[model samples]
Target: MNATATAAPKAKANATAPARGRPVLGRFPLPLRVLGYALVVGVGLVYLLPFALQLVTGFKTDPDAAAHPLGLVPTTPTTAAYQRLFGLSQAGDGVPFLRWLGNSTLVAVLVTAGRVLFDSMAGYALARLRFRGRSLLFGFVVGVMAVPGVALLIPKFLVLNSFGLFDTYTGMILPLMVDAAGIFIMKQFFESIPREVEEAARVDGAGVIRTFWSVVLPMARPALITLTILSFQGSWNEFTHFLVATQSGQYETLTTGLARFVSGGLGGGTQYPLKLAAALLATLPVAALFFCFQRYFVQGANSGAVKE
Candidate 1:
C-alpha cells in the first residue's frame, strides 16, 4: 500500500514537470529562431537599403551620383539639389519650389479638415441617426466610390469652370473636401461600436450633437487618426485631379510642378536626383504621421477586415 501510494505521487510529480532539459528549447528551437530573425532582418534591409542609397545619392554631385548610382557613400556631397529646389543656387530658370510647397500645404490642410468634419458628420448620421433618404444617400455614396476617378476628370472640370472655381485653391480643394470612401469608413467604424455607450449619453439627457462631440468622438480616436492620416496623405499626393483642375503654374502643387519638371521633354532624360528629392520631401509628412500612428492602422480599417 505504501509503495503504491509513493509511486502515485511520483507519477503525478512527473506529469507536472517541464518537458525540456535545455532551458531555452522549451520556447523554440535555436536554428528556427535564428532563421526567423534572419528572414525578418533580410526583408527589412531589402526595403530600407534603397532609401538609404537614395538619401546619400541626393547629397552627391550630379556627375558623381550618376557614375555611382548604387553607392551609399558619396565622394562629393553637395547641397546643389536642395539649393535648386529652394531656388537658392543659380540653376537657370529656377523653380518656384517654395510657392509650390506652400500651395500644396494649403490645399492639403483644407481638404483634410473638410473631409474629417464632413465625413464624420455623414458617418454619424448614417450609422445611428435615422431620417428620410438616409439609405438612399448611403447607397449613392457607395456608387460614387465605384465610379473610376479617371472618368470624372472632364465632367468635374466642366462643373468647376462653370462655377469659375477653376485654377483656384477652392476648385482644387472643394472637389476633394468630402470623400465618399472616408464617409463610408467612418460609418462602418461608428456602427461597429456598441450602442450601449451612446444610450448612456442619451439617458443622461445629452443632445445628439453634444453626445457625438464629447462622448462618441473621444471614443473614436483610433478611427479619427486613421481617417486624418489618410485624408492628409491623399490630398498631399493628389495629382490627376489637380492636373485637370488647374491651368496656371502659379497654382501648381509639388505633384504638378514636379511632373512638368521631370517630364518636360518627350524623350525623358531622367533627372533622378531632382525628381527623387522632391518625392522624398513630399513623402516626409505622411511618413512621419504613419510611423507615429501605425498601431491604429494595424487593425486594418476596412469594414470586413476587422472582426469586432
Candidate 2:
C-alpha cells in the first residue's frame, strides 16, 4: 500500500506520453504549417487593426479625423492635441490633465499595496491556521467574488457615506483594496506549497507571521508577482468604483477624467487625437508590466490544473 501510494504519481506522469511514438507537433506537414501560419497572421491582423486605427487617428486634426475615420494615414499629423493636454497650446476652459494623472498613480499604488498585503494575510490564515469559522469565512469570500461589481455601486456609496470616507482618496481606493478574487488566488497558491517548508521554519523557532513573511512568502514569488500585476491593472483601469466613490472633479483619476474629457462635453466636436494620447499614456505602464512579467502570467494560466 505504501509503495503503491508513492508510485501512483510517477505512474501517471509516465502514462501521459507514449514510450515509442513520433512527436505530435512533428506530424504537422508542410501544407499544414502554411495553413497554420495564414490562420495565425489573420488573427494577429484582426487584433492589431483597431490599435492601428487608434494610433493613426490620434495624429489627425479634428476636421481630418471626422472626414476620414477609416484612413490609415492622418491628413495632418499635428502635435496640437498633446501640446494642449500639456498646457502649452492654450486650455479652452482649463482641463487639469496633470492632476488627473497624479490622482490615478496615487490610487493605483495604494490599492495594489493594500490588496497584496491584506489578501495574503487573509489567505495565509485560511490555508494554514487553525481557527473557528474558517470554512464559513471562506464561503463568504467565495460568495463575495460571485457578486457582480456593478451591483455594489449603490451599496458601496452608502457604506462609504456612512463611514464619512466619501469623495476622499480613502473612499476612492479603500473599497477596491480588499478584492475577493485576490484573496482566493493567494489561498490556492499557499495551499499548493509543500508542508515541510513551513514545518522546518517553525521547528527553527519561527512564529506563524515570521514563517509567512520570511520563509513562505519568498517561496511564493511567482504567485505574489502574478497577484501584483493583476491588482495593479484592475485598479488602474477601474471606472465604475471611482464613479460611485467620488462626486467631485478634483478626485478624478485617469479613467474617470478621460471618460468625461472624451465623451462630447469638453469643447469642440471629436478631439480623437487628444483622447487617444491620454489613453495611450494611461495604458503604457500596465502594458509594460504585462509584457515584463509574462512568465508569471503564464504560470497563473496553468495553475488551476496543478495538484500538490
Quantify all predictions' global Cα lDDT against the true fold: 0.84, 0.86
Q: Write the per-residue lDDT of candidate 1 for residues 38-138, one digit (tens) a residue.
A: 88899999999978877887787767877888988989878777887888877464567788899999999999999999999999999999999999999
TM-score per candidate, chains pooled: 0.86, 0.89
After aligning candidate 1 to the native by TM-score, how far in Å is the CA of 83 from where it should be?
A: 1.1
Q: What tens digits encode model 2's per-residue C-alpha lDDT throughout 1-308?
A: 99999799889877866744655545699888778879889999999897788778778888888888888998778877778777777646456788888998899899999999999899889999989999999999999989998899899999999999999998988888898998898899888888999999999999998999999888777888888999999999999989988889899989899988888657777777788877877888899999999998778645623749
TM-score attained by model 1? 0.86
Estimate the overall C-alpha local distance difference test score of candidate 1. Answer: 0.84
Question: How many residue pairs clash in all the candidates, one count each?
Answer: 0, 0
Best TM-score among the predictions, by candidate number: 2
Candidate 2 local Cα displacement, residue 99, angstroms:
1.5
- Number of the top-ranking candidate, with lDDT as the measure: 2
> Which pairs of residues collide in candidate 1?
none
